[model samples]
Target: MNKYLWRRIKYFILCIAGLLLALLIWGVIEPYYLDREAVVAEIPLLSPSWQGKKIAVVSDFQIGMWMANTRTVAQSIDRIVAERPAAALIAGDFVYKPGDNLTPELDRVIQLVRPLVVAQIPTYAVLGNHDYGAKAVTEASASDIQRADRIQQALEASGIQVLKNEAIVLPNADRTAENDRLYLVGIGAYLPKQSQPQQAIAQVPSSAARFVLMHNPGSFAELPPGTAPIAVAGHTHGGQIRIPFLPEWSWMSFVEERSSWSWISQIRGDIVRVSGWIPGYGNADNRLYINRGIGFSNLPIRFNCRPELTVFTLQAKT
Candidate 1:
């Protein structure tokens, strides 16, 4: 009888071990094979005159790995441009890693999309935590900083303005005149080593219709009261996994809280909260739009959530 019990226990242990191994592979390795989902969100800001303006939002294209095919990336950009937005906003993470030789390929991708940038629509970008991973990892070498600089130069040359805790006003159709009706503010990646967002938003005229570009959603919590009308971000990558009924602690939880997992709630008081600009304020306001992102991070697979190119139409509230 004792011998029989020992045999049953061994089988149970083996089954548990096998299940664990499968889960590890699914989470870290096989995830790259999953298809990414594309989604669009229409947000209304405080601007009544600027309503009907369309803005394209793209974020977290790690580039070389999941998006290695320049043609694929180009095609995606073409589709986005087809929407004819007044402006394009990139939330950050252009390159996968510092040492990765994605320059030539990235340059090619940029060339395909160059026409869109040079077009009437203004294109703006900000760095993400991965862009400054070398700095975050602590062991990053001098070469890392040099690589980061090179990437920045290339992106700028491509006509995509890279904002590092800075603000730039986008002129309306008049070109020569400053359009106080709308403003674009960019905050550097929320990584502690980078510039602070509080300082970046300060550069913009507070009275204008403020549209903030930030990489991580968490940065919204740091903004001063009544800063911007809407803040855009993409770093959470939509939790990278969206299994129904399961606890969200799977993967993205390791980074920011689950609040970082999706379009977050807007905080409001004397200041405009990130969620305020949404359809509703607090839980109701449409304050922030977090992109699911294009490329894969850490692991190569994506399931349920396909890569997305977000086109937001800003209409005047009736």
Candidate 2:
């Protein structure tokens, strides 16, 4: 081959090699790597009594999925147990797709998370889109719904309080004041049928310091202001396959959010209305934080963003 042709051939070879190496990192290594993030925030309405309280959050365990790492799940839970946060919140997607191995998979995930139960932390959880077992974001069959119900029961049996369009008022550990309280409002997932932020918020007293929990960040728009000064969710997985700083590059988002190229904006706009209002393009009040969650769905690869387990410390916004 001539020198020019030889160089072109060499460049082509290098490009192929680079692609393989990247695949190795994204598909193999990154999925298992635990990215611990401090979800620190000072919300405007946080009560003085609940100051300096910490809450641990995990999402998208999605066990039984093709690339769902059970080992990583243990590490994340162990770390949270060690931290001994005042409370722990699991944002759903505990089991990926309950195929024939649903029974075995549920057992596996329950064991993996039992440590949290034994640790005695006030834990809470919500159902995710996948948990519904629907066909591409639509409601699943009765059997699928039954499967989800069983999983919810199993989780509750493990001592994790699964919240569904409900509010639970947990007393402040400090106990300095008789009336000190922290409200936890857990809403249903937005994808299938059970998303009702309105119902959950209606039960919470506006003056109470509350934090809303849900699996999908898209539900943030449905939440009214003052309900949750800071809402926590994880279904977006922070755009699981983010491309450096350009969100548009993350085409994988479309697949997960149930949209086609034709009406991507409308779908996402409906799903993530909050992303448009915040200063950085998120919730209207900038009170929502979408956890870059752990586990993968459909695809095993993750680039730029690693699996996450977040610890949030909240103080009154004074």
Poorest 10 consecutive residues by lDDT, candidate 2: 273-282
- Residue lDDT tens for model 2, 174-279: 7565347778899986777677889988997766667888887667666665456688887666556665656455635667545312123433332332121122
Residues 1-318, model 1: lDDT tens digits: 699999999999999999978765665543333222333333233454466667778777776665343444455577667777778888888766655575664675477668777665678888776666532413434665566667678878878788888887765663433443566788866653464778887876645566778887767667765565467787766656555444232355455444333334443334322211333332223256667676666666544455666666664432
- Report the poorest 10 consecutive residues by lDDT, candidate 1: 273-282
List candidate 2 stretches off by more than 4 Å: 257-286
**TM-score, every prediction:** 0.71, 0.88
**After TM-score superposition, what is the CA distance of residue 38 in candidate 1 from its true location, in Å?**
10
Off by over 4 Å in 1: 1-48, 66-72, 100-102, 118-120, 134-143, 174-180, 245-250, 255-286, 316-318
Clash counts per candidate, in order, are: 27, 2
